[model samples]
Target: MAAWQAALKWAGEHWSPAPHLHFVPAQQEDLPMVEALAREIWPQVYRELISADQIQYMLGLMYNVPHLEEEVRTRGVRYQLIREEDGSMVGFLGWELEAGSGANHSTALLHKLYVKPNQHSRGVGASALAHVIAEATIAGASTLQLRVNRQNRKAIRAYLRAGFEFEEDRCTDIGGGFVMDDHVMVKRL
Candidate 1:
């Protein structure tokens, strides 16, 4: 069986009803909330993987309200705020459909997938991933891809558990003297 299928099966056998989660599409008015969540989650998430300065720089570059709004308005990216059954926010996901070139198939680029540090190991990430995969499939994407920090072993393992195979290594310089050294992983739909 495929890794994702096996992972889903494992989740089914383990978590009785799974986590009651909701994915709310982010709007212009909702950008500030999304930014707030990022500010809260990033320091904890990247404390070990990156320096404080780099983290602050990245947050300012990627999670700033104006930048996020531009991403939604101009780039066709989709951002969703993940919430619980009680209507409390937990995490968020960001993705965009990339058009195919020549013989390549269209792909879904998972730009972000983050959960509160306290929510780890409770099946929130798995459920969120399953939702993204189903949504991407419904949108006609043949594959899903993402770039994860090379040093983020926890996230790397999670992606592997979800059937994403390592595709390549990329070292990108995002200005401000900071670099993103990541592993590009892909899962065929």
Candidate 2:
């Protein structure tokens, strides 16, 4: 199979989080919080590696209100929010299941998944991941896939801990003069 084809196939596996994280589907009313998350995670996560232009474009394409609304409406974009015991939105995971022709493949793409910087290493990210994967598994999805910047070791470690194996053959490059250099990862149920 070609590299891209191989990647898609790898993306079609089941994944589950370790434990303790909750997954709640996001609603239109959650748009504000979602937008806020993009804003928050951006400076903390992307500002260092990506240029301002890249940041603007990525955030515009991924987290803008209209984009999220569309994801909620037509796209199978499921938003799973993570919170603290006190009820603050600590992190979130956005994904699309069975997005294309391979319905049985039950593929999912994780568009947004992040935990607050200060909250790192505290299991917030892991819990959110588990919540998202559990939801996908419950929906009968065969695979769960996401693109993590090759340079992001922390996020990559979390995915690996959740049982996702690096899909080196299926990296996707979404052009705009900005390269994702993404590593496709998958886990089987």
Spell out the clash pairs found in candidate 2: 12-143, 13-142, 13-143, 17-130
Give the Cα lDDT of each candidate.
Answer: 0.87, 0.73
Could you estimate the TM-score for every candidate?
A: 0.89, 0.81
- The all-Cα superposition gives candidate 1 an RMSD in Å to the true structure of 3.3
The parts of candidate 2 lying over 4 Å away from their true place are: 1-22, 100-104, 169-176
Q: RMSDs, each prediction?
A: 3.3, 6.2
Tens digits of per-residue lDDT for model 2 on 76-102?
A: 677867776567777777887755536
lDDT of 1 by residue, 1-189 (tens): 477668754654464324588899998898898899999999999999999999999999999999999888876788999999999999999988884422346789999899999999888888888788888888878899999999999998778777788999999999999999999999887
Which candidate leads the pack in lDDT? 1
Considering summed lDDT, which 10 consecutive residues are worst modelled in model 1?
9-18
